[model samples]
Target: MSYTPLLQQLIEALRCLPGVGPKSAQRMTFHLLERDPEGALRLAKALTEAVERVGRCDSCRTLSEAPLCPLCASQRRDRRLLCVVETPADVLAVEQSGAYAGLYFVLGGHLSPLDGIGPEEIGVDALLARAREGVEEVILATNPTVEGEATAHYIGELLREQGVGVSRIAHGVPLGGELEYVDGSTLTRALAGRKPI
Candidate 1:
């Protein structure tokens, strides 16, 4: 029997999520329909609200509901030390380690010319502007991937031009591994053992 048009549409919509295939989408649609309708409603509502309410932090470019992210807004954080990462997930991973007490600047993404993503596309200018604002140290916590390395290098150059101290996170992070997937201890070590860029 064919699924209803609305159900099919839901499945298709779910497939747009990263790593979610047709089978996973179909299974999720069925599970949401049968086992957890209220949960699914809450999920839908939260997704809508997050998409509408959450936006990039004006200064550091991290995702925020307000003009600045919680980290940027908090006076308790070390404003002098800044950790630069590729995404909000990276920020969360570093935060989970409880190692970094400084503020963060999320690039939103890495440099990828072939993918049509450039410095302007990833808000590198905003990050450079932030770096110019008397920050003592800027940690390049981008992933160990090619694009991530390129982004780190690009930012390092910009910060060096501004006479700002720049450092790259230590190689404790597995080669080609994403920060979000690395263990907390490893992340902590990477942060603590950071070296000059």
Candidate 2:
């Protein structure tokens, strides 16, 4: 059983999406072509519009259409504090927590040397350039992965040289998880990072 050339192309295109395997792509292609072509057109139009309009914010590098993101442009935010994250999604996660009211600098990715990704690829220089611009403290909110830790350390050292206060986000067990159920590595970190009551 073979699909037409156009249908095959569509399936391949859909496979490019994250987590969309060949079977998932085939199912999506059929659903779009057989059940809802109109919906497919809407998806295509919206994706095209977003691709054309969305770009990096000049100040923070998060996804935005304007020169500066709303957080960077707002006077209400604490300009003295900056949070460095690895991606736009991380910025959204921090925003949803509602605990941080500072500006952000998105690295867009972690540093992976074997992949040929380095400070230059992740815009470390750009972030360093903004360190002296009234940002007294930089809180590293990178993920808890090894690469994320390396990135945070690298950036922290650079910022310290610029006379900026740098701090790494704490990592340990989850708020709701029981101590017995926690993994040894997490428990070890939790114990190591224990705070005074």
Candidate 3:
């Protein structure tokens, strides 16, 4: 049995999403085709809108539909304190914890030499540049992974040279747990117990 060319193409494209395997892609295709045609159309429209309208925040580099993200635009957040994270999801995690009332800097990714991803590729230069502009403290909130550690150390050194204080978030976070997966209470405690780098 063969799927129509359009269905096969859609399934193949869906498989490109993170953690979506071929079987899952096929299941999703069939589910969408059989059960929820309107839902599928809505999903397609939302995906296209997100891809076309959303972009990186100019100040913090987090994903945004406007020129700046809500955090960047908010006067309530402490501009002097900056939390450097690997992605927008990290920022959201920290935000949900309600423990951090400071601004954020999203690196977008970690530095992985094996993957040919370096500092420049992940917006490290932009972060360093931001650090030079009277930033008081920078909390490294990157993931608890090897590449994430490398990125944190690199930024710490750069910020230190710029006369800005640098700190790394506590490793009390569970091993292999992404910030997005950790509960808000645990994340709050981690932020509260952060140590200097």
Q: Which one is best on TM-score?
A: 2
* Model 1, runs deviating above 4 Å: 173-197
Looking at model 1, the pairs that clash are none
Q: Who wins the lDDT comparison?
A: 2
Residue-level lDDT of model 2, residues 1-197, one tens digit each, is 99999999999999889999999999999899899999999999999999999999999999999999999999999989999999999999999999999899999899999999999988998898877888899999998989999999999999998899999988899987888898998889989999999
Clashes of each: 0, 0, 0
For candidate 1, lDDT tens digit of each residue in 1-197? Answer: 77899999999999989999999999999999999999999999999999999998887887789998888889899888989999899999999999999989888889899989989988888888888777999999999877888889989999998999999976678788898999987798788878898
Candidate 3 lDDT by residue in tens digits, 70-110:
88998888888999999899999999999999899998889
Per-residue lDDT for 160 in model 2? 92
Off by over 4 Å in 3: 173-197
Q: Worst lDDT window (10 residues) for model 3? A: 168-177
Candidate 2, which segments miss by more than 4 Å at Cα?
none
* Higher-ranked by TM-score: 1 or 2: 2
TM-score of each: 0.83, 0.94, 0.82
Considering only N, C-alpha and C atoms within 3 Å, which residue pairs clash in candidate 2? none
The candidate 1 region of ten consecutive residues with least summed lDDT is 169-178
